[model samples]
Target: MLIAQISDIHIREDGQRCCGWVDTAPFLAKAVDKLNALRPSPSAVVVTGDLVDSGSPAEYARLHALLAPLAMPYYLVVGNHDRREPLRAAFPDHAHLRSGPFVQYTIDELPVRLVVLDTNIPGQHAGELCGERLDWLERRLAEQPNRPTAIFMHHPPFKTGNIPLDRLDLSGKERLAAIVSKFRNIHGVFCGHLHRAIQARFAGTIAMTCPSTAHQVHLSLGESSIMAFDMEPPACQLHWWDGHSLVTHTAFIERFDGPFSVQTGERIEIRTDSIHGRAP
Candidate 1:
């Protein structure tokens, strides 16, 4: 099974742009197109939060339209920038979003069981997993201890060395780590909030963050480094599960140069007409 993951879309309503210049809608549309055009199409797409620039119904509506072209099933997780009620209202057909008080659920149909966690703390830039949420996760993990599972959330429980980003790290991470350490079935913990791709060892498993489909957080590692964003190449992560283990690849959204033949130095003609637009 192939699963595509995109994060931090930060879509704004029509005629509006994120951070005064980045029109996140088009970037997401490109991402959708890229995912749809994949060779071995993904079974599902998991969007790891920041679905909009603001927690507004209008923005959610815009997001709804942008994601409509996805060829496969897609799931959403709550991030700091998303409003649970507005998101639920936007996609009433996504019953999983309304499963409980939080936007957390499980996708048991796939080879790799997906357990989505809600870590959003409304009106705040940081993320948290309260006792209730953590307990719910523990119970969920205990239910299928032998299943090959993956955890999805917005905030990463481990530090990424980016000082400013680390400051907004997930609260209750210690307890989360403790709980995750007991689960041998957990293959990976995927998160987003960082706006950049990063990985680290966590609780005997791999925890990683996906890059944004729009602006990316600048890679500045130091105690005094400030928070900032840059117009990096937008991309999505593809996780391929071949019955036993998962392999991940980063697929860029924009069309790039040629994939020339390495041995003969010949230009290989491939389709480049799909994603012609560049990220702003």
Candidate 2:
């Protein structure tokens, strides 16, 4: 089973560009087409938030238009840039999101259980998993103690080393770690907020972030480095599970040259044309 994660689309309303610079809509369109063109499309696509730049109704409308072309079923979670009410209003058929004040739910149909968490604070860039949210998660994990489960959230519960982004990392991480450590069946935690691909070990499990379809955050490890954007190769992540091991791979959105295969011999050489396709 394969699952795709697309994050931080940042669709805007009217002619305004995200960050007043980048035209992110085309980036997202390219991402959508790329996913649809996969040989075996992913089982489901989970959009890890910042669905819109300002969380406005107009922007959500545009986002709806942009995502309408996706061939696979999709799920959404809220981020700091998202407003729940508008999002809920935009997609009323997403029953799980409407059931509670938070956009947390579980999908049991997939090969691995999917547990989504809501970490968006009403008016803050940083994240917080309050007692209530933690209690809910504890109960969810308790339900399936042995099932291979993956948690989804907007903000990663661990620091990512980018100083400015780290400042906006999730609060109450220790409490989260303690809960995660108790469940051996919990396979991984996937999230998106920093607009970059990141991975780290957290509470004995792998926690990873998906790169955005939009522009990426400039990579800088210096203490003085601020939040910035760069025109890098955009991409999405595809996760596969064969009932034994779960492997995640990145699929870049751009179309490069031929995917030719070469064989080793006394002298190995690059072959661009398909050997079998050519009439010999």
Instruction: Give a tens-digit lDDT track for model 1, residues 22-87.
Output: 989889989998999886678889999999989899999989999998989999998999999999
Structural similarity to truth (TM-score) of each candidate:
0.94, 0.92
Highest lDDT against the true fold, candidate: 1
* Model 2 error, position 123 (Å): 2.1
Residue lDDT tens for model 2, 191-261: 99978889999998999999999889899786955789898888898877767656889888888765554
The deviation in Å at residue 63 for candidate 2 is 1.0
Q: What are the per-model C-alpha RMSD values against the true structure?
A: 5.0, 5.3
Runs in model 2 deviating more than 4 A are 264-280
